[model samples]
Target: LLLPYLRNKGRSERVFKDRSNPLEVLSEKELLEKFRFPRHAIQQLAFDLEEKLRPETSRNCSIPSLLQICVVKMDFFNISGFPNVIGAIDGTHIRIKAPSTHEPLFVNRKGYHSINVQAICDAKLRVLNCVARWPGSTHDSRNLVNSQIHDAFERGELQGVLLGDSGYPLKPWLLTPFLNPETAAQTLYNTAHAKTRNVIERCFGVLKRRFHCLHGELRMKPERVCNIICACVVLHNLEDQMLEEPALEITEAGDEDGSGHYIRQMIVENIFSA
Candidate 1:
């Protein structure tokens, strides 16, 4: 029901009515009759379960433990021919219904209402951190600055650098790709950066593929939508750890902001020129 509803909410109610029991398919009508409950009740039960089972990131990866993540990530990057990388960070837009108030703020550059969800993922495609509450109009850099990861790094609670796209700022703890490459070493740096950063893109693809609800426009309030996103992230991480699924292919996406361009250039010279 969740699958059908998420894929096409308008046609879901009629879907279960058309299938037969002999075909090993129970129509929506049959399930409804057997369960003796309305469709809304079932949906509500699923949401309740999700909320109850939502995994807490702090339990698995606390502030102090983040340094350990840095160690693991650096080793992972070494295997991939990149160095000193802790995690890959990026933001994706999650479509949502326009709110009654401040509806314009929810409209993104793509002219759709959404939530700008920022996430940091490790080499194994596990979501290390997620921030789902920001409106679509919020820039990726702004979201990063407000994220718990950023706060932890700022307070010296976490160590190592995170690789991001050009959309993010380049600080001592955050590294982004070069805007343009005029030297062979800079070109090599960009190549390695792209390869290492591709993990976050694959992570998003796997996440959206597993949870169809995120593929379509979420028909809930912003707060509920954020909760659902967080729940899905928890489930994705659990599945990633437990299942032996095939690897996800890497894909590329562009970034917009360059607030830390100068900082990025300085770091690029220091690392790649050596």
Candidate 2:
């Protein structure tokens, strides 16, 4: 019924007898199995969402803002570590529609039509910032370039390296593996730096593994997909608060994040000096 309405303009509701919206793509049992939301309750929630999101169905709305309201209500804002502390940044792919003609616009170097969802997390692995919907075709560096991260670096709001995996380009604001040398000196230095910087990976692994929804098919628009990611991040922070896991690393302190002042401080000055 809804599918015909969506396909044909000005179709009268009288032609359809079933209350079931065909476009919903889920039966009551299926919704319970997949989303765990009670079918009746989710029906109302979906209606409310359409009312709020598609007031006119003409103007686009931001997914992050809606997610922020839900997240801000959770008591997970105070992520530990300060001054010398900031979150790490990294991107993960969420599957999406393959463009009809412009395949290159969606094809990533990783070989998929996905968007890069980059996030910054605090020492405790709670996300402080999330940048979603950057095209998969863009490099991690380019995503940061076209993101609020550059602005944060310029404003001196972020004064530390956003610890990342090797996919990220080396910059003062962004920290990656040391490329200078493979000799004894550089190898030891790289090992030490990797220690403190790997917190983001722990966060990412936990996020993707625990919340199965994040890894599933995103049927909505790109913006809604991003909102779903943001919601998951918010949920992660809330769970962190509830569980309060002590210092997510299993190894002793000195193994990660590299040696002290030199590398981390260099990253800080290089970026914050902006």
Candidate 3:
């Protein structure tokens, strides 16, 4: 009796079954629809991360990394005739469980608990940078201002300008649409900016679609939620996927830099005026 009890004590009661691998069974198109990544890219990503992540027998697991593969060049000029634009910047809100600490800080204008995720994307809809640590109550401009990319631009570490919505401050390296268009050139610039910056909205759509957890409320702690968002972003960038887009809004008017206005005017006159 003691020997039989000892043998069963540490063993799991659950039975194991051999499950068919989706990577092996599904077609490329089917894989893309369900996993939001092509079969080849999925294989490559798994191969690259094999050493870092180990599969388990029971509970699901996730791998976190900021790994991004830039298979194409960074160029946005071809889109909407926006000249010399490298990337589009914007902020999105991801819903999460209300934290026990400072719950009010997570309530956004929409009256929900969420994280304000700021993401920058190139013309290919690949995420170039993602900042997911801000609360939903935080403004989009504030997130950008506090990001490392902002410091990089200030330090002249990155070239080319970024297209953003009016929620962001206009800077020498970042261009925002004109609130009131005075000329055809300004109108044209706003049009081009809108068309070009639209990619970031689409990027959010694709990321959320690929990782359905982003579509629903993340039940984890705030810090873990942020890590999950970043991991999803890295996975999203690993594959070239397509999805829908979202709308934008205006906010915070007084932070525009003087040199930024000059640069916008120059671009309007030189590029769009024609």
Candidate 4:
């Protein structure tokens, strides 16, 4: 049912014809009879799988492993002329059903209900960290600031700088592009920053393209939606590590909020200008 549904929704192409697989040609009633499970039971099973596979930083990640990731990403950026870059950070909105309470909080500037999911990805297209509990109304910078990854960086527990876009603040630990590059050096810096930060955009694209549920509206509750998003991210990372092929190619949606624009400009002028 899921396979036929994905193909019908135009999320993926049919891999097998009706003649090749009798199951693929079965009617909905026939399929249901073969499965012998109710719709609600399938949903419950999905939820159980999500809970079992969702990524937990403490359980799935370690300091030594993180340092190894940093070293690999740093080398990748170094070849591109961006020094000490560990990861690319960005946010994408996941559409969800409107909530019963505080509906306005879920409606984003695009006039849709969603959850803003922030993720940091390494050069290898692996999700190093993810935060998916924030409402779509929340700014990307605020979500980052409130995340455990931010606290970790603040405590100097992590090494190297993160490459972000202009929507994020420029800190000693994080680098954002120059808003208006007037000089050749600033132009060069902005070019490098954009090129390096684009990895996160591609990461999101691959994730959404692989998970059709995320590409379309998720009808589940907000909390359940968050769980599904995290579960998908964990699965995406696993697939990337295993070098699995992607199902489709999807473009990324762009977002911009000037939460730390002023501070970013100051850092660019004081440091990058020199």
Candidate 5:
């Protein structure tokens, strides 16, 4: 219901086994009568959230307040060897109307029609950032351009090594697998670091497994899509924050090699020509 839109979409999208839309339970008259929401209230809430989120210092405002809250609230992603721990980044396919003329935007490199949504999440699997306008054809590496990640890195606003699958390349500030070999020693070093970075992967799994709504087509304008995603992430983070569970636990038995470096390296090469 509106509660998911307002509260728990992030932590438990699949909490209800009944897949039927809850709104359908209402009769037609009730739907007509009750579907109306407080538009002024919504507008005021949006304004308040924007005020809390938008910066007074910069005219540039591609970022929204909810996303800004996600960034500021990233105190819980305990990525090893890194700090700030904002999120792990990746892309997902969202079904969309076929482009009227810009067919290439909908046609992904994988030979399908979809919109690519790049997202970042913290350690507890709450989405912290999202970019929705990129065509499905774009590579995750190339997609970073014109993105907040690009600006954040340029501004030195990002401090931690973000976690990702093999689809991203490695940089000093951004973490990825080895692009070239320095040695067996170098390879091991990267593997260990990457294992530490897999929290982002787990974050993706946790969110997707919970929110089946996100797993399907989301028809909305590009900007609204970004807001919907941020709202869900904040809602998810709120759930985790409410829970008293531990953030992460350290284990001491397995070899760092448990996560194959070979697979990770191939991901780096394919995702980034780096």
Candidate 6:
């Protein structure tokens, strides 16, 4: 009787272990399908959660776990060779009903009534900052220039470079690709910049896909529409998991710093030069 009970207990333990250890048996594609993320991402998640899931030794002696810190890894450099890129910034037009007061202001270059939503996102397509108040007629550069984030960057309150397109002016913290590639390094820099900046475009696509309301015209007041857009952005960030604040790399802001040009040149030499 004791021998049969021991065998049954061993079989149950093996079954439980096999059920819990899917990573060991699942292929990369299967892992992605099951977890909605890649194998490495799942591994990273496991690594991040190990401490939080660890058993507490005694009452009141357990270390407080910060589950939010798991999302801090930007890994933007992994996609493109560009270094220190914390965010990618871009503006997308959100179609909305014609406003009664500022109907003309809402008419975009595409001849559609829309709101120009400026968003900055991390490598993982998580929205870091979003501005949905600007009218469709506003230029992308103008919207960014008038935004609080611009002031923050100017004040050196934030760190890491933001990858933008030719529509945005280059700064110490904001990098745009070269229109005319004069040399091999400049060409390489442009290639990396384009690849890196493409993340913001993908981010916008994912956002619109996740929230189908954004694909069609929003039949509401501009103010209400803005609120909806902001809400969507917040939800998108929550889905991706919020990242920790990046460490600041302060730079002097004055007299339209031409240091951007110098910085670009240095990046071309150090990073792009092969």
Which has the greatest TM-score? Answer: 3
Query: What is candidate 1's local distance difference test score?
Result: 0.73
Task: Order candidates by lDDT, high to low.
Answer: 3, 6, 1, 4, 2, 5
What are the per-model C-alpha RMSD values against the true structure? Answer: 10.6, 11.3, 10.5, 11.8, 14.8, 17.6
Q: Which residue pairs in candidate 2 have backbone atoms (N, alpha carbon, C) closer than 3 angstroms, thus clashing?
A: 87-121, 192-258, 193-258, 195-256, 195-257, 196-256, 196-257
Extract clashing residue pairs from model 3.
Answer: none
Residue pairs that clash (backbone atoms under 3 angstroms), model 6: none
Q: All candidates' TM-scores?
A: 0.69, 0.58, 0.71, 0.69, 0.56, 0.69
lDDT of 5 by residue, 1-274 (tens): 5986767655755564867753546555554576553444445555655643443333553333444434433553233333334456777766555655677767776677666777776555655566666777878777766675656654654444455655765444455555675666456645645655565567656666666666666666544555565555445554575674423211100112323455445434443233
TM-score of decoy 1:
0.69
lDDT string, candidate 6, 157-220, tens digits: 5656788898888789888889999999899899989988898999999999999999999999
User: What lDDT would candidate 4 get against the real structure?
Assistant: 0.73
Query: 1-274 in candidate 2: lDDT tens per residue?
Result: 6887676766655674678753377777887887788777767655654443332211342223433333322222233221233446677777777745555776788787877887766556676666776767877767766765556464554334455666665555555665664455445445544655566777788888878877776656666777777667656765666686422111000013234335645544443233
Candidate 4: list runs displaced more than 4 Å. 1-61, 65-67, 244-274
Q: Give the winner by lDDT: 2 or 6.
A: 6
Model 3: weakest 10-residue lDDT segment is 244-253
For residue 181, give model 2's deviation from the true position in Å.
2.6
Per-residue alpha-carbon lDDT of candidate 1 for residues 1-274, written as tens digits (9 for 90 to 100): 5897677856545454555432145556866777765566656656655653554455544343554655656655774566666678899999999998789999999999999998878787877778888899999998877766776776766656678888776676777776878887788779888888998999999999999999999989998999889888767866665685422211111233354466556556776676
- State the RMSD for candidate 6: 17.6
- Alpha carbon deviation, residue 237, candidate 5 (Å): 3.0
> Model 5: runs farther than 4 Å from truth?
1-86, 179-182, 219-227, 244-274
lDDT of each model, Cα atoms only?
A: 0.73, 0.57, 0.77, 0.73, 0.54, 0.76
lDDT of 1 at 129: 75
Candidate 6 overall Cα lDDT vs. reference? Answer: 0.76
